[model samples]
Target: MDKQNSRFRWVVFFSVLFTYLLMSSQRTAPGLITEQVMKDFDVTATTIGLLTSMQFFVYTSLQIPMGILADRFGPNFFLIIGAIVTGVGTIIYSLGTHEFVLFFARILTGIGDATIWVNLVLILGQWFKVKEFVRLIGFAGMTGSLGFLLATVPFSAWIDLLGWRAAFFSAGIALCLTGILLYIVLVKKPRQLFHNESVPVKDEIQPQNVRMLLKRIVSNRQAWALFFCHFGVVGVYVGFISSWAVPMG
Candidate 1:
């Protein structure tokens, strides 16, 4: 049972990993579609900026609330819903004939994208041992980097062959299928009871504690460096690789 459960946990890990890949791909897909989208909707450069920027905006603004909701409900719930919404949002974006509709589609995609990673952390915490958790996070980061990598050359070719609308819709269909698999497999896995037993739950946070936590992170030079490292490295990577790489290349 232990070995079987361990294998199953890894299965769950890959599922979430690929979902994270999808998240990364979705963020960058706008870059591939930028020129086509602009011509299709008859929008300006600023509007294209705003449209692509909306995903990050929704992702950044919702982190705190998403964490809270994940705590109250469950990480699995968010992962499933996020996948479904992401698919629906992509389909919506694919079908949009007007600028306003496309703008709203980006907002919807952002909302769905915002919920993914935090919940992934929670789900990983539940399934892996303490030491394994750190390694798993590194693996997740690597997968995310691959996502950034794949979003350009292959995705661009896909757009060329299928055209942007069909390409977006194909991804949406795949995402929805993955969401269904996630819902079926993890929700009722045979090892679910043991998985629940192994994972430790943290103490609930008081609203007031948020301030102290932020202050502590802010005061630490090491922590600040890490923040900037992520901002500089990951932020710049995503912005360029996902958004501008095709055009630049």
Candidate 2:
């Protein structure tokens, strides 16, 4: 039973990993569609910048709050919600004929994207031992890299064949289907799946401790170093690879 349960956890991990892949894919998808978007909306690159930034801005703004909520509740609920919202956003973006609709779709996508990674961390932590968790996270990072690569050449080819609307609409449907698969396969706890009576529920963080939590995080030099490093690397990638490079080429 132990071995069987342990094997099943990998199934759950891959389900979430696939969702994370979709998240990263959509994050960089605008690069391929930039020309079509500009033509459709009769907008400048400046407006395109705003369209892209709207998703990032919302995703960044919601991270802390979503993390707290996911900790209090559970990640499974939020992950499902994220998948649905992301799919809807992509579908809306595909069908949108107006600038206002496009902006709204981007915001929705950002909100969904915001809920993914922190929840992924929570899910992985719950399901795996520390060493296994570390290795799985590295795999997750590789999955994201694959997503970025897919959003580039393959996604561009897709757009070229079907145009952006059909391509993105198909992507949206795929995301939603992946969410359904996640719903079926992801168990919040190993005990839940395996019927282990000895397993204990994890303690939830209290609301009042948030201030202290923030202070501790703010005071951590290592955290700040990581924050700056990630920010610099992501900033350059988003600014160049995901937005401008395609058009320049």
Candidate 3:
């Protein structure tokens, strides 16, 4: 990689990392403020569960479609859309005064949140060598954990000081700004940055290709095993962490 291309890749890394951090924070922030939200909305715990569930439902349902779209259009396209949608959704949620509106907001947020993981992986593959990808992905996971931390202690403090609405409103604005930054700095692939003709670019996706990809993935027993494992472990862990843990504490 040329020095200019090399330096730009780190910028891409940090920008996308920030996007993931904000995504993680949004996922977990509601957990810590459950009681307050319940009181304000005159809602029961089950109602609050639905709020979290709405987000999760939309998020999980869209994963394969998001992956296909990211493959088709490039990760940066969806990243921009995701960031802005998340920001707007959060803003609406922050300003919401009714149950229906809140649910709608979560749904929007979920759609935006759905875009991150697949695209993040794709972008990493585009920018980094295979050896570096593993370490970078590990670091990305750690950054997500840091987002959980931000959503906990510091978020709690923000709620105490600024109120949850203001706290989330600020976060929404930050995400919107992040979207703009992504638009300015993010390229579809390294080809754009390095002017390297040898770098592979995505071809236009075809219906048959999509079907083949799906069919192959679906037929992979090992893939199914991994899917179930992730679904069971991460699903339960995220559910508990973002819904019950803080409230129970």
By lDDT, who's the top model here? 3
- Mind giving the per-residue lDDT tens digits that candidate 1 earns over 1-249? 452346788888889999889877888888887777778778887888778788888888998889878877889989888888888888899898998888788888898888888999988887787789998999988887787667787888888889989999898888788788789766877346455453224634334566786788789999989879988987787766544556444
Candidate 3 per-residue C-alpha lDDT over 1-249 given as tens digits, one digit per residue, 9 for 90 to 100: 652248777888899999999987999788887887898999999999999889989998999899878877789889899999999999999999998999999999999999988999888877777788888999898888888888887888887789989999999999999988888777544447666545334633444577888899999999999999878997888788787778333
* Candidate 2 least-lDDT 10 residues: 197-206
Per-candidate Cα lDDT values, in order, are: 0.80, 0.84, 0.85
Give per-model TM-scores: 0.87, 0.92, 0.88
- In order of TM-score, best first, we have 2, 3, 1
Residue pairs in collision within model 1: none
Alpha carbon lDDT at 164, candidate 2: 90
Best of the two (1, 2) by lDDT = 2
In Å, residue 152's CA in model 3 sits off its true spot by 1.1
Clashes, model 3: 0
Query: Best candidate per TM-score, number?
Result: 2
Lowest lDDT 10-residue stretch of candidate 3 = 197-206
TM-score of 2: 0.92
Score candidate 3 by lDDT: 0.85
